[model samples]
Target chain A: MTATKPYHHGELRPALVAAANAIIRESGIEKLSMRRLADQVGVSRTAPYHHFKDKNALLCAIAEMGFEEQNQMTREILDDPEDNNNEAVFARWVRAYIRFAHENPETYDLMFGREIWKGGTPTPSLQAISKTSFRLWVDLVAKMQQRGVLPGSHSALRTAQASWAALHGMARLLIDGIYVQREDLEEIAETVVDLLTRTTPDSH
Target chain B: MTATKPYHHGELRPALVAAANAIIRESGIEKLSMRRLADQVGVSRTAPYHHFKDKNALLCAIAEMGFEEQNQMTREILDDPEDNNNEAVFARWVRAYIRFAHENPETYDLMFGREIWKGGTPTPSLQAISKTSFRLWVDLVAKMQQRGVLPGSHSALRTAQASWAALHGMARLLIDGIYVQREDLEEIAETVVDLLTRTTPDSH
Candidate 1:
């Protein structure tokens, strides 16, 4: 009770989210619960309930944070002036995306795992954020297509889907420990980039 | 106790695996347990203990079944005399693979999910089956490359890995219900086939 009183009301939501993130990172997402998270955050058991309707809602919030972080990282990479070539910029984004998934496996799973998306029950806000992130990829795909960096023979949407599927698949394999060899990530990423942009004018 | 005496010892392994598959299909994998499965099978709880070491071992057995089924499907597709053209056969195989994953979501999840592969603890038999399935794919990739159906510039192993990653990614997306346009699967498969074999002699 004494510990609960010190945290301002405004701090409670972020505090709970931070604690939940820590729990999921240190342990696995299956180990998280509203009651346990409340205890970890030094709040009343029901306090977290006020902020998140249930575990799914809390997971959506955490996934939302990941999308925001990923979107920002992508934007930073795109805006950087150092790598002016389209292939170089795109390759850097692919590597960064994989790196993010590897560094934050639990959070990455939350962002793309079956828990939220399987039933189409993700919180509306979370869905919107995910769509925004995907939209960014689609836009980039369109730009690359226009610049002759990607094959223009296919529609931008289909091209984006195929390319994103490759990246997503590789990331899942690595993050889930199916592929097991961390040293091969770079080589695999390069191979994928080569496969995607092989038909480009610059490549020839 | 009388129920336990009826089943011969030799019949138990396949019986237990079949029950586990039915349980996973009817409900989700999380609802499956040895005791409940034993009850469902009209056997003593200890009966399942003799067949499966634990849930992980049981899951591996179930997954091993999926791989065998998938491998048979791929073989039948390859051996069909009707589609001798390499590109047509390859496209048919890709579509069949995605269709299998979509139709058998629970079984597919077990086959590729983190439950078996995350800790590198897949049963030796399961690993052997998975390797055999992959070897089939790598062999197909090599054949396609030799026939000028896939890019010869990339080594067969790397090409196989990249191509499999794409198919695996698409399968995961569809199976998890993340990408839920059943109508678009054929088109997506066609697009993937085009992407993979765009440089082929017949494609040109």
Candidate 2:
């Protein structure tokens, strides 16, 4: 009898996600579908279903990677001894955040856009990763407060949320092309850093 | 011969835009189509096409209305003599911006989302209204600087972009559901106002 060949693709999960990312980048998330993605990846239509329960699940996985990528970049910025000064560190971090969004508009949209969150479609895994990522930000805010880089009068959670909203807002503006001129990024980032780090009388 | 009934819908343009807004609110912009909208509006399929060249044109029209509504609200807030103090005026404006976005998520998204701007699809009419709206914000920022509400160290344009970015960011967060916890809106708005208006050494 002839030996039967294994039907499994080498790394179907990662392969599907990578293909989805490419599709989303080339077109947009709205164009992505399980059958289309499977076809693009040279797999059976049902094969993707086994890995991701549905399209939302696949999007969540893609967004999960975005969070991980952002978190790693954040860690690298924080750990860099070359820019230990509070202001420089904070500025670099803000720039990095915006740069990430600008470079990966599709992924960034999936990570924070209305598609997942507003639609109430985030998977349990997506929620878990996103919560952890947010906690990391809160912890960093507390550290900045301790170092006098951020105002200490407000709670760390509050400070993190407010400051993050600023950075996130700018990122969205740039990514969405609402801000128009790309040259304004540096000035805008500087202004944001200054506003966020200005020592208040109450904090002093 | 009996007189032919008028085929023209008296207010086809406004009626089509209104139906489009309702459809977008209920099922998102992607689900909105010219054929479906015409059917919902009790008009011939080609009727909407006459008013709007395509779906993008319809979206631009809706977003144009959003800009008009927001600009009117902003004008009222600024013109109101009740809140004369710099901090109060600034805070009220910020809160009003967030409230508008929160109340009209889909409209806000269309006005500022990547769907229109990133696709390079904003109509000339939409562009004109949006430019006017942004210019109004810049003018307000300059006025705030003159009044010592915002730091004079930075250029009015830079400060306006940055401050507006923060408010815009916060609004996007709230509208997208990424911020979760709707109860924190008030506190977050207060924190943002404080950050934006804190006395700078140069200003002092």
Candidate 3:
């Protein structure tokens, strides 16, 4: 074990989450163990319990961090002050999604594949926070449709769903080792964005 | 245990798949044990080993069965003689996807999740068969553009990828119990179909 770090290290909650994420990144969630995590942090085996009730609780917190990171990235891209147009908004959102999925394959799987937040059953704080990220996508698409940049009366609803599908499919393919490995994800991103943008009302 | 049935049931593979799917529907893949599956078929525990080398092998076989079923379903929908127009072509494919996702969730997850494919490589049979499904989607989009029913250039590539994204996203949400539980899937499916039917040639 390492030297003791004092209690109350400015903000133990966030610190603990960062530590947990580092472990996940290195060892995968499957290999994560509570005792090992506590020892690594130079804390008593039970100290982690003060911050998280159990392993699931800690996992939820880690997932929340991942979701927030993903949402912030999505918003920054979609709500860029300069690229607020419909095509830009839609395409950028898709790009953000693929990038997030590829970069955070483990966390992405935990959030979506684990069903940690069942629809309409969003009780956990992390689960609720994750769902909020999806709202950014919904609102971006809605704004674009309102501007007459896209067609379909339910453009906001359907397009958001559609965008999700395209991004999810691409990510799945990428993670599944499809399309061969590529250094430039931007190529795929641009291809997806170009397609979604062309589907806009102006395309006709 | 039930008595033995005739070996020449003529649909041994399909029957086994159906039985395995029923097990997945009632429980999850995590609950699918080979001995239990063999018991379900009134065979010795060793019986399944002949068909599948192990649990992973059985899962691959089941996934293969699902891909074929999906391929047939997609073909039926895409080749609807009455709905051969561009809009119809897109709608039918999207609808087929929705139906497949909803009706056979276990298969859908196995096909898309990429985790259960065993050691990150799909069996050769699964790979060869499902790869055709990808071409079907891209080909339909290309044909729609060629017929001038859908507009813009590169509709084939764009719509193919975008449509995949949307459909895959929704299917994933449904399987993981996160996306469309509260909404009428049929209505949403219609909306998705409508969204894809529109000509966004520039999108591709």
Model 1 alpha-carbon miss at residue A15, Å: 1.9
Off by over 4 Å in 1: A1-10, A44-47, A79-83, A200-204, B1-12, B44-47, B78-83, B200-204
lDDT of 3 by residue, A1-204 (tens): 647755655566666777778887776665678878877776767778888887777777767777888888877876577863445566656666777777887687667654354222333786578668777777877777666554546647666766565566677766655432444345555655555554445533
Residue-wise lDDT of candidate 2 within A19-137, one digit each (tens)? Answer: 99999989887788888999998888889988888778889999999999999987887667676576677777787888899888899999998778876489988888888888888
The prediction achieving the highest TM-score against the true structure is: 2
lDDT of 3 at B13: 56
Candidate 3 CA-lDDT value: 0.66
What is the lDDT, from 0 to 100, of the residue B32 in candidate 2?
85
TM-score of each: 0.89, 0.91, 0.79
Candidate 1, B153-191: lDDT as tens digits: 778877888788888888877766554366676677677
iRMSD for every model: 2.7, 1.6, 3.6
Q: Lowest-lDDT window of 10 residues in candidate 3 chain B? A: B149-158
Best by DockQ, which number?
2
Q: What's the TM-score of chain A alone for every prediction?
A: 0.90, 0.89, 0.76
Q: Which of the two, 1 or 3, has more TM-score?
A: 1
lDDT value, candidate 2, whole model: 0.84
